[model samples]
Target: MAVFRSRFARVLAVIGLAAAMLVGVFVGTASACSCLPGGEGAKYARATHVFTGVVVGRALLSGDPDTAHDDKYRYLVLNYRNHKGSAPALVGVETAVGGATCGIELALWSSYVVFAQGDASDGVVETTLCSGTRLASGGPPVTEEPPTTTTPRPTALGGSSPACPPIA
Candidate 1:
């Protein structure tokens, strides 16, 4: 009986440690991506822009080109206005059908549409290749709003740009 009890305690200890480690990893990952430089997730949470760009490519499966992965996966490349306003920067977003995948691996993008949520640091943003239905028929119009006192502030850590610069 004593040996059985000891073994049970050991098993419980291992399980507890494993659970704690899993939680730590999750929290760390969330923090890293929360305000990732050039990541749209953080921008989306801030609600800076209502509509951004248009989707240009068809949704493709992760690995198999022959299969249509629209139901399983969705991705878009967005042409967004940059700070200079000289041209639009293209941002890419690849998201799971559901909000299951969240991490640095997924949040990193070349170009993407950034939507302001509320708080830039803590809010969550949805990054995509294009703005999807958010944009007008001809894409987001060029209209400049006067700099407002309530404008979403720029990211302190230089996150205003995309994770990867547009290739073109």
Candidate 2:
């Protein structure tokens, strides 16, 4: 009886440890792509084009010459103005399409400020998840607006910058 009790206790302890480890792996922890925290100036400098636009179209690009599919590249069509590069009313850009891939997620008709690089080989623009392509703030359109009194801004302590900078 004593030996049986001892063995049971050891097994219970091992099981408890395993359960805790498994919980640690799955509880409130998810893997995500690491992106650079780029300021507006830095992102603008790196990007070949920067503009506000709406994602109007998307399609999965074929990798194989024989119509095989690959998630590494997806094509996006955008309608934009405030011409930063050219005067194109519509343009296509390459992006990533899967969990393992790295590119901004775009929904149809969603507005965003896109930072991208132009691919000379295909004459297409390319953007990544980390390339500073971000959703436009809530407004009638994605266009810029003048500072409003309703806007919540951090008050300055003295004659310096805002006292409370926004958190990341």
Each model's lDDT: 0.40, 0.65
**TM values, all candidates:** 0.26, 0.54
- lDDT (C-alpha) at residue 85 in model 1: 23
lDDT of 1: 0.40
Please give, for residues 44-82, the per-residue lDDT of candidate 2 as tens digits: 667777777787877776565653224545445564553
Which ten contiguous residues of candidate 2 have the minimum total lDDT?
A: 139-148
